[model samples]
Target chain A: MRITIDEDKCCGAGQCVLAAPEVFDQRDEDGVVVLLDAEPPAEQHAAVTEAAQICPAAAIALA
Target chain B: MTEAPAAPAPALTTRRAPGCPFDPPPVTQELREQAPVTRVSLWNGSTAWLVTRHEEQVALLRDPRISADSRHSGYPTVSASFEATRAHNRTFITMDEPEHNAQRRRFTGDFTIKRMQALRPRIERIITDLLDAMEQAGPPADLVTDFALPLPSLVICELLGVPYEDHDFFQRCSAVMIDTRSAPEAALAASQELLDYLEKLVEFKAEQPGDDLLSRLAEQYLLTGESTVDECAKQARLLLIAGHETTANMIALGTCALLQHPDQLAAVRDGSPQRVAGAVEELLRYLTITHMGRRRVAVADIEVGGQLIRAGEAVICANDLANRDPEVFADPDRLDVDRAARAHLAFGSGPHQCLGQNLARIELQLAYPALLRRFPGLRLDRPLEELPFRTDMAVYGLHELPLSW
Candidate 1:
């Protein structure tokens, strides 16, 4: 699965990081989304999907 | 435009049913089931759209047309104190985006999940120390005062560089600030006192910057001209109050809820760290402490859940009700510790979603398990019915939880 995040739209709630820590992180400066893995392993897909679905800002997208 | 319904709108303020302190008011559940989007009369006799379903609340709260600016004439407030002191207590939470985003980002870095995770050891230490003190004092301790309240208050004080010794003064002030029934003058005085205290602290931080949030705000915003001293202080005051009161209540109320359900309480007490974390989410969903619905105003006409909310109409997204929406959680009312309840609207949704949620989550995750583990035979000293719940306050919680181990 491919993952993408719109940093501009991220409110830094860190839901994505909480859901899939391996695939996402927040910038240390402003807590904006910091994509750690563009293509995570199969085991992480479900959590990544949940992250995208529950993101308050709808900032994360998956393909 | 959709024609108005014939029935008289119910008042927004509804009491929880007797003997059902954990449940939302029966009226709220009925509305969520029958009419998810409908008008409700506010305290001031003005009407606002009350959105209760989870899906509709998520949709409407995320819509840019629904404004969070409390200054808007149509914005619904929970109390006279809230309305009268609205101007004095204005912070980023009450502002619309671009501006809101700008101000909120200033402190989000310090509250990120990773940053908060790094504070876990420190938080755990604080919890252990409090429990040690509570144990030393023996049984029949007021957990609200001795444990729950101080845990978060101390953590927030340390994080913001505020002296924990003055908790009595600030917590007293915070009580009036959150009390829905507080007089307008009392609320204003409380808010002014906190703002003034924080303003002085910001000036002190500017002169002697420390490794804390307030110091960073002082160095980056107050000194750099990015924000005025008053603006910095207001934000600080917001964090100080928001950081402590909500989490403190959650600690106290979550404990009460868990103790009532032995199965859930045991799950939290004996569960692994992972299980404890999941239980925290369920507790947050089950006893959503922010009982006062998130207030907003419609800046443009919008249709949600088959109802037309006209421009300038106020809106109250009853998140506490939405968290209990059956569509989102199976058997929504049950407090199952193992449930995947992370999607709950306890922290709200959209851009204005709580910035301190990560920190709050960490605090709770550490607090609940540590608390139960420390006191294996923990039980409520008073009957649940006799407990004084903070229904009079905007944030729902027990005013005092007398616990005996």
Candidate 2:
């Protein structure tokens, strides 16, 4: 599965980071979220889906 | 240079404590009978105007003349540090439009009525799970500790993608963030601790990525560098703190209000889900749990309702008063459980209205029925007078609602 992010729609609400921290980390200073990988591995399916569900901004897309 | 017979310092026209300090003042009736805009004293020892009439409140709340940011309003605060003040100010609740709109737009997906309703099953399971635990623990249970408080905390934790078990730590840390007497330094330290904790959690989510709000925030906004990491952590903190604390109080107090009125409770319990939804609206209006008014600083001298508000003056738009305005509601205190609750300002009006209103409504709708049905014989363990009403906290609610079935 591949995860695509819309940077403009993301306001660093951090639901994604909380859902799948392994694939996402927001910065320490200003809190802009950082995606470690554009497409996470298969092992991250559950957490990735969880992220998609919880993103209040609908900034995450999975295929 | 002392003058004899000095004029009175500014004071709010407060009626005798309407049950408790946490409770709303008797402005609705006065506004309905007398002037819509009347002068009142603030708890901070300053004078301000209370907009009570339904129409006036709605217009004033929506007007551009009022500002939602407390800092600009000379709004009296108890936080220790300016930064701590800023931390609590992370969410758009304190913002005006454009900025507020931009911020809210990001989180709008999870807050739609449809979205909140879709989460009904999960909400039900959560409530049942908590009630089951409460039942296992037996009677004389502290509803606040066992169910009321933990339910929203857990739900918000899940929604935010933070670990629910961390409720205790965050709850404690969140305290100084909202304590009425917390100095700026103390509040900032507490806020920083939470931010630090959340930052680490974000790292974990980044590496793993989950379906939680935090993971997506990291993946989308933070990862792209549109906003800073601290900004992202602050956003997470805002959700966890405001979303959890406010809803926790609503459940506890709303439950207590229902238990106080058996007829109303029975109506909601026996009626269809639609009826319960109506009952929830009425309860939100009647209770208006977030009694603290939204503070606004008058940027330019302007006359509102009938009062002339001066530039730089701080005013609190009391939602509780707006909820009970006789002009809008008939027998506002009767708890009919079917009043035109849509007219109430509990979720507020204008651009700063609660983004979580949809979620809160679903929580209440799902909670009231599940609660009454699961514990049909549920009753308050102590009299209302003896119950610890939270006056010191930012959000007013019962501290520990002891109940037995």
Candidate 3:
């Protein structure tokens, strides 16, 4: 799956990072999500999906 | 062109219905139905937009134009005391954008799900130990003082490197700060007391750092020159107060609510991990203990729910009412432990949603079942009406919960 984040909508609640740290990292400056990998192997797909589901701002989108 | 008739606005009242202690104020329900985005007169004689609909609240919280900065003119204050203390060193909660995000990020690591999960064993130990003491003390215990309050207070104290023994002092100050009826001078005094205590604690941590949140903050913010010692202390003070009070109340009030619904309480007491987690979320929704509405100001003109809120207009997002918005949760008033209730605004919404939610969740997840499992016959010692509830405080919760097995 390919993952992307809307920087403006990221609320820095940190749920994304906790759920899928391999795929998502927050910018040090403002804590906005920083995409670490656009596409990950099937092994990490569940984590990515969970991250998106847990995001309060709905800033994460996966295809 | 003739102007249409404007819906009459109901005056905001904090008093919950006479005996339905678990429900939101009666007038709040009326306003949610009649005028979800109507103007209500506050205690200070200032009127602000009181948004009650679940959809409207979520939209407003996410809108970039809305500001949570309490310093802005026309920003709705909970009371005159809140306005007086607004000028005190602002916590990240009251900050807007860039600054808010920057400050909030500094401590997010400590509250991340991984971190909170790691702390679960420690939190469980705390809960177990408290229960042991309560059991030792025998039946007819005031659960509020004995179990509910101390569990969170001790955990927070450990996290921040603050001595739990000093809880009485800090708790007193926190009570003064959040009490809307408190005098302005008293509020300021409380703020000063907590700030001063935190300042000293932060300074001490700088010299003798430990593996705790305050130590990390001192190293990162104070020692690195990213922030002043006082600024770091102010942030610590805010966390210290919020870390304990909100959860403490939730524990106490939640127990009271669960006892009222024995069937639901049974599920929470004897359920799987998934069931317990869902129960926690549902309880958070049903008893949105933070009854005082979130206050904000519009930095730009925004039209929502067929009403145009001009720039500088104040808005109060009443989460209690929003949580009960029938459109959001079917039979929103019912406390169904198994329902998918994670979307409730108990922790709020948007960028400024609660920082310690994951930790709070774990605490509740562990707390509810443990308490019930230990004392299966737990029941209120006094009638519901006789128990003291914190109606006047900023956070809605029971002041003292008397219980016996």
Question: All candidates' TM-scores?
Answer: 0.98, 0.80, 0.92
Tell me how far the alpha carbon of residue B111 in candidate 1 is from the true structure, in angstroms, after superposition.
0.5
Indicate whether candidate 1 or candidate 3 has the larger lDDT: 1
For model 3, residues B1-405, the per-residue Cα lDDT tens digits are 112237554577789887899899998888788766888888877778889898888889877899999889898888878889998958889998878877887877677666677889999999999999999999999988998889999999999899999999999999999998999999999999889889888989999999888998899889999899889989998889889999999999999999999999999998999889889889999999888887899999888877888899999999999889888789988989998776688888877899888788899999999999999999999999888999989888988999999
After best superposition, candidate 1 residue A11: deviation in angstroms? 0.6
> What C-alpha lDDT do the candidate models reach, one value each?
0.90, 0.72, 0.87
Using TM-score as the yardstick, the better of models 1 and 2 is 1
DockQ of 3: 0.36
Top candidate, metric lDDT: 1
Worst 10 residues of 3 chain B by lDDT: B1-10
What's the distance in Å from true for residue B392, model 2?
Answer: 2.3
lDDT string for model 1 (B71-90, tens) is 99988988899999999988
RMSD of each: 1.1, 11.2, 2.9
- The full ranking of all candidates by TM-score, starting with the best, is 1, 3, 2
lDDT computed for candidate 1: 0.90
Fnat (0 to 1) per candidate: 0.72, 0.00, 0.35
Per residue, candidate 3 scores C-alpha lDDT tens digits across A1-63 of 778788767776777776678988766544567898998989999888978865767798988
Give a tens-digit lDDT track for model 2, residues B1-405.
121114543344333264543346554345446566655565556656656666666666666777766556365332234325753555676676558767766676666544566788898899999989888888989888887778888888888899988888999888777766677678777888999999888877777889988898888887888767777888888888877888888888888888878999999888898788788879888888766655566776667776777777766677787787766788776788876575567777655667677678788888878888888999988877788876656777877899989
Cα error, residue B346 of model 3, in Å, equals: 0.6
Tens-place lDDT digits, model 2, residues A1-63: 878876655544454664577898655433345778778888898888867654544567888
